[model samples]
Target: MITTSRIRVWDPLVRIFHWSLVAGVAANLFLTEEGGTTHQWIGYGIAGFIGMRIVWGFIGPWSVRWKSFWPTPSRLKQALRPNYTAASSDNITHTTLGAVMMLTLLALLIGLAVTGYMMEETTRFWGVDWVEEIHEVMANALLLLVPLHVIGAIVESIKKHDNLIGSMVHGYRRVQIPPQHMTKHVDDRA
Candidate 1:
């Protein structure tokens, strides 16, 4: 059995943002009445959450920062390669594929929010079928992407030997440190 140490990866803000967004999205999709007051408020809340995340991505901790996991060409290639090893240094927090997924979801949510708001305008975009169609398409895309996100998280948790779902909830991850890298102390009685 391999022993590991727990590290604080996701901060409170990040975790809250994640679950809050999930609840908001789920409520908007499944529970809330479409085009109703509750739905519009939830949509606005999601927009606000996304806006905060954008700002936080710049000033957040190393784990949540965009620079830490942004999908560069090299990183994307490394992540997409077959039989990739998670022990590598590049596999710290978010994988390249995870980065791409995050960005795509954010874009979709933003588009959905914009179109939804436009649909409610009833003046500038009144009777515009395209706006409603675009909103539905984005929502459907989210239905597909959310499952992919969950599957990817599960796969990565198993591959990395860490409870990623728990980490998202509790903001911690069990990190395995190499034996050689463990701190050593010298004895004075030589």
Candidate 2:
């Protein structure tokens, strides 16, 4: 229940990207009506934001780095069980499920954007029923996954003793940082 204010943990760019994607995905989920130009635009925006995220994952803060998403079998097992131990401050980032969701949503959003673009073009993929169907399926999956994402955030906030949503907005967390392993300057210096 501690709420100590701290320096920025989520960089401003990361915060903006996070919220933009959230808004875009939420809009994309509900605006699928025929001739919904706004919805299509939002999907494109989400795709762009996701692209930014992929780049950011490569070059963003220590917390949001692509290495953070690197799949570790041990971490995946820990995430699957209830006895998962929180990593040090340096290791504090998406867990296995979080990484999977990030990848899934990225693929789905990109698929939607590419299909939408192709669907509009006169050549190739245009008027292709299967492409349109895949787009719809991915959109529906996004709608289903978003609520689960929210629930996961809530549960993680409670377990980790930090407000996950608030951290994104204000860019900070109050979790205890483990030593030894966190002191490696290899990644930080690169």
Candidate 3:
């Protein structure tokens, strides 16, 4: 039987923020009526979530902190190395491209929220066609990004032999422990 050690990589707050953002964006995109109260509230909630996440990135656990996954030049180089493989690494966190995607998504979401709010202020932004156009373009971009994110998660999960989707849902990930470390736990049990 195949087995691995599980670690609490994602804290509850991070997991909740992730799924809540997903639901909010999906609802706004596919379910809520445009320019309605429900849609506005959902957008506000998404904005709030993003705000909280930015704060948490500074104070959260090591695994969830910006330092851990931020796209630095060296880190990006490592991630892009020809021989680099998620399956070969014990630290299974965001890849370089994943980090870039996340940063881009955050910026886009912020832009969407700003444009959406501006579009509502008729006195200030009335007849502002460019604002509406930017909002629609960003929304479409998000729609495209969501699927690419899922596909990348699936690919990494398969390569690493871990349930990455479940990790987000349950806040845990199967981490590979070195054989030398395994003996200490076994001896303690005996």
Q: For each candidate in the order shown, give its overall lDDT on alpha carbons.
A: 0.83, 0.71, 0.83
lDDT by residue for model 3 (1-190), tens: 3347666778899999999999999999999998789998999899999999999999998778998888899878887899887577545567777888888988999998999998875668755999989999999999999899899899988887888999898777776776654422222211
Candidate 2: count the clashes. 1
TM-score of each: 0.88, 0.80, 0.88
Q: Is candidate 2 or candidate 3 better by TM-score?
A: 3
Return the clash pairs for model 3, or none.
Answer: none
Candidate 3 residues lying further than 4 Å off, grouped into runs, are: 1-3, 179-190
TM-score of 1: 0.88
Native RMSD of candidate 3 (Å): 3.8
**All candidates: CA RMSD in angstroms?**
5.1, 5.0, 3.8
Q: List the residue pairs that clash in candidate 1.
A: none
How accurate locally is residue 137 in candidate 3, as Cα lDDT from 0 to 100?
99
Query: Model 2, which residues run further than 4 Å from truth?
Result: 1-7, 32-35, 81-90, 179-190
lDDT per residue (tens digit) for residues 54-164 in model 1: 999999887788998899999878767887665454445787888899899999999988998898856888569999899999999999999999998998888778888
